[model samples]
Target: VLDRQGLDAFMRQIRSKFESSLIQDEKNERFPGYARRRWGGALKTLLAAIDKV
Candidate 1:
């Protein structure tokens, strides 16, 4: 099992990866804003659950 510090680091890594992908998608101009909204909400929910741990 991961300690608190490890969990925090993992969360930061996950967040960084998510943000980078979102930025890349914006640069590619492939997905629409509505799609991004859906994805962002999903990520937020996932992160919230992680925080509970």
Candidate 2:
């Protein structure tokens, strides 16, 4: 039980970090045009799904 709890906490931390990174990438305008536009919408969708999980 303890191991499972620890793993769950670790997974949550990783998810949080991933969400933060995605947000930062969306805000960064220095990326090439294709990446900037394409990834922004995709990442937002992915983040929403992650939140649901």
Candidate 3:
């Protein structure tokens, strides 16, 4: 049970982590495409789930 502010903070944290992962994927050479695709899907699903709520 998160209040509105808590929810916003949580979303910001998640977004930051995902953004960091994507940035790292761009910089690293190994499996960059795969990692980016997986994280991209997770980010999309997260946004969709939050929108539903």
Best by lDDT: 3
- The lDDT, on a scale of 0 to 1, for candidate 3 is 0.71
For every candidate structure, what is the RMSD over all alpha carbons to the true structure, in angstroms?
Answer: 3.6, 7.3, 2.7
Q: Write the per-residue lDDT of candidate 1 for residues 1-53, one digit (tens) a residue.
A: 67667767766766676666656676767564644565566667667766887
What's the CA RMSD of model 1 in angstroms? 3.6
Query: Model 2, 7-40: lDDT tens per residue?
Result: 5565565556655665667677676354434555
lDDT of 3 by residue, 1-53 (tens): 66556666776876777778867877888776666576667768667766766
**Residue pairs in steric clash, candidate 1?**
none
**Model 2 clashing residue pairs (backbone):** none
Give me the displacement of residue 30 in model 3, in angstroms.
2.1
lDDT against the true structure, per candidate, is 0.66, 0.57, 0.71
Which candidate comes out best when scored by TM-score? Answer: 3
Q: For candidate 2, report its TM-score.
A: 0.42
Candidate 2 segments exceeding 4 Å error: 27-53
